[model samples]
Target chain A: MSSVSFKDFRTSAARAIADVRLQSAIDGATLTFRTGRVKALADLPDVDGLRDQLKAIRSATLARLADHLEMFEQQARAAGSHVYWARDAAEANRFVLDIAQQHGAKLAVKSKSMATEEIHLNAELQNAGITPVETDLGEWIIQLAGEPPSHIIGPALHKTREQVAELFSREVGRTLPPDDIPMLTAEARRLLREQFLAADIGISGANIGVAETGSVVLVTNEGNGRLVTSAPPVHIAIMGIEKIAPTWDDAAVWLALLARSSTGQPMSCYTTAITGPARDGDPDGPREVYIVLLDNGRADLVGSDYDEILQCIRCGACLNACPVYQEVGGHSYGVPYSGPVGAVLMPLLYGLAENEALPHASSLCGACLDVCPARIDLPRLLLKLRAEEVREHMLTPQERLLENAVAFVLRHPRLYRALTGLGRIFQRPLARGGLLRLPRRLNPAGERQLPALAKRSFRSMWNEIKDGQL
Target chain B: MITARDDILKRSKQRARAAGDHPPAWRSRRQFDDLSRRFVDSLAAVHGEACVVPSLEAAFARLGDLLAEIGAGRVVVNDEPPFSGVDMAARWPDIEWHVAGRSAGDLRAFCAAADVGLSSADAALAETGTLVVTSGPGRSRLVTLLVSVHIALVPVSRLTADLFTWTAGRSTPPPAMITLISGPSKTADIEQVMAIGVHGPKRFIVILYGDED
Candidate 1:
């Protein structure tokens, strides 16, 4: 939404890495989520079995997503909800704007939704002269700070308590203590409650869309998800096309694993299933319900080599387990979805040209694959994206030439050995304590040093040993 | 537009893997011998309180004590079975009482302003200490959501083994809304520190009655 180029990643990541407070926040938050996920899964009985079952369901549903989408549209319409299809972000935002304008809506309350963020709905609404109030605590903080979410689940994990207190105090026009978290929470609750009561429309993101029941299930620990869906006269749920779970049984498996993977809870405090608007005899809930299905380049990936990326549930476990994410933090990704999932999906969804650097952000450590509840092979996807980038000539000219030279050397063993021997002889002056310290301008790795080539080539040593010569 | 829908479906049909048979059946097994005991212990683990009573009369007696202890001056109760027969207005004559679906005042506002909201749990899961309440004619969604403290009366017969079992036994068509509440509303958004009572009820108390004295 903010329009960032991958070329800026190095600068942005360096800035983020240099912030001590940010490093502390990132380290503390990710460690907590990682350890909590481990303990929560270990406490459950047959956690792996449930994950396997969920994966099977996800794969099966994706294979027949079109049929499931038809069923969902039919069932949702039968249950009195209007279903709309948006080919891209603009169409989706236009539908939401039309609904808000039709009702003369002035203020709209939003629950935390990565779909909404992905569509850049807030800026669109603001430009349209309608105020969109984010109700999630972390989201609200970042909204007030005029920044995008830094984490998929915790939108403001980048902000410290002192920073939050400062933000809240500015809003309340009074100084509040930084250490009093409960007081800050109460202040936020009191402030958002007014917006909830007076808003004309509510917008949310669906965690899962059930085709058989025509229900959209949302899971949240805070009650904002419920309030956003319940308090307003009209409610709109924007969901990715890949979020379909065809049956109630499939939904049960998702519910079982979603909270456990994301927040390490047996279940989030609330798991709400809304089939449609308030029924005939219901006293509360929105009168109008709409679900906007957003395609936005995902359909192209449906049958592509990376279709398994569709199985991702946005649990943020991969983010917590990612080494790159832990070091550079989420803001460096420049998208709402970050870490291993971002490295793969950002290029696939946005385009490889814009995010060519993202695929290289990982070390292919495979830690993300180990923690993913959906078991998405993020490392494999990253490698595939990198290969595509190279094949498409997306690399810089210098990089292309370097790659060509390396390939040429690798093909001819004699040239490689001769060059290495020459490099060992030529690098005596630049080699400092076995590390090649290149100037910042020439060094592609920036601050990091390269290990100097071995003084004696391995091939020569192997040959000498085979000949019984020391 | 229909064209967008058609295009998306076309791409999906062309690209998606062949659909497999319906997913393997839900196979979660409940380990606890006494589901009610397991439910109580599970509920306690999530900062919720649960008590077992012999009959509806005993539960009502305990309910009265809880109301007095909470100093509930204003209360909202759902007009569903069991709760509909409690005669809350007559029992607590002085409190501003509102019964959902049968009250004179605005039910949503009353639930929001009331100190305690009461409802009957249609069913519950013992494994996760979850209470499933569906929105229908008499059950208002806000009764348990908007109050400071929520008290639900559960019958032991309505307890299920877990979510898997609950879905396996679900026979009727799905309601307009089904809420599965496991604990009091909570958030860890601020520095990943757990905070309670962000928007929903702060205290969740369940009265599991009508079996095994």
Candidate 2:
């Protein structure tokens, strides 16, 4: 993943906030998802109990993830699947490319897989002279526009109907109406169907890798996942080492909560579990199956402070519930994973120094925890990352100086009171209706005014009451 | 140089924490007074069609009616249990029948060009209105996936309370592939607007019938 600096986040977030079309699209999509999630969870008999059960399952699985992964590899090999372990993205991408090259594949169809996005596999495929077609409608839209996904579940939620129509019109070399969403969707289906049939290889990500049966579970509302895994002669699935379930029973619970939290569905339209390639008598299915287990810094996080992030099923419920994500949209995070999860995961995966701004992206609001099916304490993780940043001296010298000075004044109540009294007098010229209308050049809080100092201090009122001078 | 697998395993082991006790199995309290009614209502909520009939003969008649109602000329059927040994071509002589794995022509080609794909569910979940289908000797995965419309004949006896009940009761090894389909293929990808039949069946129909005594 390319490193997005703090400056980049500021620039892009400002641009996203100013884009009216993008703002409305994000708002409408997130609001609908939030409302749907509430209704769906309300229907559950014991949602809190289910969430606790899920958290236990995930934490326990992670506690001995290596054992489960080894068991999975053994079972998958028994089922005739070739399992390859990749230490990082380069190795994973190289393995996939080698498979494509060995098969002389020209076109590779892919389902929506964040693991692939994390490894930047499409560009590698393109560079190797193979065409990678994203089969998911949302992923395809972003792929066409040459942009990263703004949201995990709804990749094109930042786009309006008019923008999508424009992109589709360009692709087909014809004029298309923006309002006719069905026609647009039908056109995509007609076009992608050919790619599914003609593609020589298929690639996907596993939502859950069951250790007991050596199965890779894929949950999708569209049938692209089914086609991508079924049509091609060779299928490759890349997954993080942490996406493992110890048993079929455990996977069932994971599946029960995954769709409900992600899209408010009782179950996704298609939940296909591929154990291996087609059986002997099976007339049609993939001929070869390859499972690439990607470590990619995930193993190092096992016992770390951020290990709970590995429990994320990537349902993206936190993304829908985050206030910062709702305002700036997902592109500001500048990663495949976005929202609160991205804010914490990116910094940990990449480095604290590299993704400094992301840890501070949140207002520390605990909405993500409330909606998380796994009940990951995202706010606590963010705080930990921030503290790590401070401990490691990731902050700039100026920031460090400012923080120290503020700390000093806060420690000295007399100085703090004197400064506040002076601040009130100095703010008389700029103060207007409880806000300080500072000049644009002098204002650091752009587009928003800072709250003015109160007319009198609380200490002054306390002293007045104490002296019976109300 | 160490192998990626060996290195990853070493690192994971080095950082491994003590394994916590496994949580107890979750038993769902979701029970329906009428499984068939809940099945129909739940399926209908997701824009799927379901009807409970009296017997296998009625179910077959309903399937024929659906094929005729859609004016489907080409139909593909999976040669699985209950569907096997049933000569669909003779029963529906007007429709072009392609029995997967037993049919002479290419199954993929037949399904791709077919108007409706038909199969029998291995099991059904009433809570979510899901049909569980597995791929094996006579069952083809594409039979229910590639076509525009998919119709399944499910015995009411196969219906369970939900996924919890289904998984807990399984005694046999899973097949090469197992799919739990809850509704017709749909997407809300573009501008968050719902559109049906993106890559799979536009309409999913379930015919539930009483088990033969």
Candidate 3:
């Protein structure tokens, strides 16, 4: 899940922006998700009220998360599931690997799961000599291509049909046309079906865990979630500690909003709530079930200012609505969680010093807040992260000096005006056609033209107008 | 690991010291006068087929017609309350049959190779046209999944107003797996193009019968 450094955010974003295909894919997919979100929310009667209710549920649940977790563990264990608590990514991966080794699982089929991706479980499983086959078409495509998912819901959104065709053709040892989408889907189904049937263990991530019933809810449009859990002898579900609801009542509201918010559907085709392993007389399902409650840096954020970050349901709605995310795509964030959420989370979950630039990746447009089902205050958190960065003296020396100078100038009107005047005079050397064309080394914006400041200051213009010199 | 669990929970409790208690909100309910009609309409909207039959005989007829339409020769049926009295194998002797826990074969292999899976809904939601099927003593999850077509026999009496209504009134512990099948398996993952029947059933047909008591 680790990629290019967040300190190199500008370089990564610039590279993504320069790729026409990446831009087009991001534009097209984000637009679809954005419009779809609008329509889906509009169809509901009083969506704002629903969003508020969901927020309250999330807030109330998190306030007493330990209680809920304990309850879930008791109930899940009673229902024949082994619940493991992992302090961090390494522990979580180790538990999964142990399960795989215990079952002698040479092949493991996986459904689309961001939690698994966040921990880089596939790489660990591969190192342990288990072929972790991704069953979700988008995840499978990216897995085959040796690339990370560019979108949360639509993992292969960055890849074009022609590229997919090439990938499929290579797998099948034959040439295939790009335009035949159904055929491509058929090919995936045929290949993944075999993995599903033969795999000894299946791994998935929980969308939400219900404490009342000890059920882990998984929503999927494709049936891979079902196949994964049902086909294997052992099923392992990894869930972030935050993904919990106290009761079935809370799970209901989450299910109601999740599909609509993400994919514009009233509900996804399948919403399975698995309490434990298969029952005694049940025909098919995993014999052993394991629930790994992952608390990787989340336990510390329980009552922090950024605690609301845990409210995110991984809908990818915020990603679609973010202007910066739409421009540079998910990979630019350099984390499994991307977009506005990633900006705030990556810095907090990882160290702020290592990922200092992520919090500033946003334009603070608040489009994310508008469409967020949980109504998480993302922009406010981003601001808090930025303030923390400044407080910790994490910014570069040049950036700090520039910020201090600007702050000082803004404090005194005379100094601000004088500095502006001097800047307008000094900028002439690099100013051309009403834009600043600074040398490549000196230009911070890099490839983007900066509009030259007006010849007259707004304050001076206002003063002149007041003197009746119109 | 246990020590980690204790430490994590301990920190979480300390941090949550300032949080106030909030009682769970009672969700406002949605009402539908004709729930069965709404159920059918909702199911149709999501590419699922649903029909209201006047009697059990009519439901059986509809199921037979659906099977014939899908050209399903080998069917796996769940042995539950709704399917108990019906000797499906005796009625359709020509078609191969495998009943959960009753059939003499490997249930997984039978389901994976079967053309149709038959089960009965424990409950359903009118608002979303979702059939709630649970795995228990006589029921098999694979009887609904791992087939080309899935036929669910849902009685009208089992219909609830919506998801909230059903969840709010829950009295017993959940089964091993409670599946809410809204429609046939689908995916728009590939360039946002909708493709049906990815891994589960391609066709989901609901036979709604047995009027409310």
Candidate 4:
């Protein structure tokens, strides 16, 4: 929604990041999530085996995605529901807007959903002259501030309690105190409750779509997602094409992993699996439930080298484990996503042209890959994106030429070794010890420190080798 | 106002089920070993707790032994198989085992009633330190939520290295809900200060169940 990815990372972060915020906000948030994942996974040391299984599962599922989709459609239809496929963002927006217009709806409530963010659903609905409210506290905060989410789980992670108090006071025309989470929460509840009672339409994002049952799985810490889907008659669930899983059991594992990874909760507050509207004698449920499967280039991904990308659960664990993301925050990636997965996914989902710099944003720490429950090879995908960006010539001319030269030299191991040796010898002045102080190529390297290289090249020393080195 | 609200609710259900095509048949779990490997590699990176014992008896014995050694008095247990053998009251007359199932109260209360919480997993991954639990008639989502010390028993048959392999198919085996427990509840909320069991369980004990138990 901000559409300001080009503002440069530092400039944007400096403008947004609050100084002297809660250490728990950073440490507590990251560690709680990290530890929950640890406890949940104490028995399975063979996650690689699981990753393999997941890979096989995703491939098989995606392979027959169309078939399964057809089955899910039939099942969903049989159970009395509607499924809409959006080729891209426009189609999704049009569908939602048209639905709102048809219902003559003026009020709408939404839960936290990345797919809606992908399609910019709120703006579209607004453009069509309808009010779409984000009911999640985090999304609500950011919505008021007019910024994209900094963290997937905590959309308003960028905001401090003080900032929230200020925002809330202003929004509600009341003087609210800063610092207490409950009081602030109470204020928010009072406000959103009014909307919930008044809204005619509710929107949500599905955690997992069970094809067999034609059920949409929704996991949430707060009760907002449930209310958004249950209270309003018109419930539109926007989910990515990849969120579909085989059955209830698989959705459970992902659900088990999701909240633990995202918020360190053993389980979220609510897990709603709505198959059709309400059962005939059901006391509560929406009258209508629409599932929008947005392709938005995912169909292409299913057939590409990045097919593993489809296995992503969007748990936000990758971002939390990401050092670069911790430092620069989500906005720095200049996309809806801002961590390692974001670096790779945004470029792929959106395109190289829009997010070329994101792939190179990480240190290739492999932390994202390490923490991913789905176990997507994030770094490999990252490298591939960088390479593809070059292949596509998305980089500036100078950057392209430089990148090409590096690639050419790297292709020939012998030449690369020779060039590095020669450069090290000739560039001794730039090297203090084992480290190169500055390459001199980076004019503004003052902000960054250069790494020192090994004194004597390992290959050269090894050629005049010593056997039984130990 | 209420009339329009009801109409929207009526319409939204129709929207959720309108399908482009039929839903595919559910797929079965395949390639267990490969799935386990990937799962372990991923968990090892996060520094999650993992233990692979040879037998269920050994795992439970190890669990009970550890609890006794720690002086933990009462215990709570989920209704998973192989749990019947863990006679906590017989071993430690002071120890109590609260049945973990639906109609459970606040997680803290359930956890407070017992010193140690033991749960039998729906599935287990040998590669990663994870216990998968599914929602059922008896199992409450809270059994895994509130305990200070949580113990999970995993069967070898469910073990896998790859997380992807299990996720491949359309059909997930019985157990409507599946949950994966890796280690004790942990939090790093305080200045990156790693604290175990901030909100849930502080101590995490695992039992890797095999043929014997």
Model 4 spans > 4 angstroms off: A1-28, A43-53, A403-446, A452-470, B1-213
User: Candidate 3: RMSD over Cα atoms?
Assistant: 1.9
- The per-prediction i-RMS, to one decimal, reads 1.1, 0.9, 1.3, 10.4
Rank order (by DockQ, best first):
2, 1, 3, 4
Model 3 Cα lDDT, one tens digit per residue, A81-189: 9999999999999999999999889999999999898899999999999999999899999999998888888999999999999999999999989998988988888
Docking quality tier of candidate 1? medium
Return the lDDT, model 3, position A215.
88
Off by over 4 Å in 3: A1-7, A428-447
RMSD of each: 2.1, 1.3, 1.9, 11.6
In candidate 1 the C-alpha lDDT for residue A292 amounts to 97
| Per-residue lDDT value at A468 in model 2 | 100
Error of 1 at A358 (Å): 1.0
Q: Once superposed on the true structure, which residue ranges of model 1 sit more than 4 Å away at CA?
A: A1-6, A425-438, A442-470
lDDT of 4 by residue, A1-470 (tens): 32323335545544434433633364446565677677655534454554555555555666666655666666777767788877778878887887788888999999889889887888888887789898887788889989887777767766777778888899889878875565676567668766865788989888888777787777664456656765667888887767777665556456646766666544554555666665543323567878877777776666577877778887889888887777667777764777787787787777677665677778998998888877789999989987887687767788778977999999999999888878877777777656566643442324345665666777767766676353
lDDT score for residue A412 of model 2: 100
- For each candidate, report its DockQ versus the true two-chain complex: 0.76, 0.85, 0.71, 0.04
Number of the top-ranking candidate, with lDDT as the measure: 2
Which 10-residue span in candidate 1 chain A carries the lowest summed lDDT? Answer: A1-10
- For residue A196, what is the lDDT in candidate 1? 88
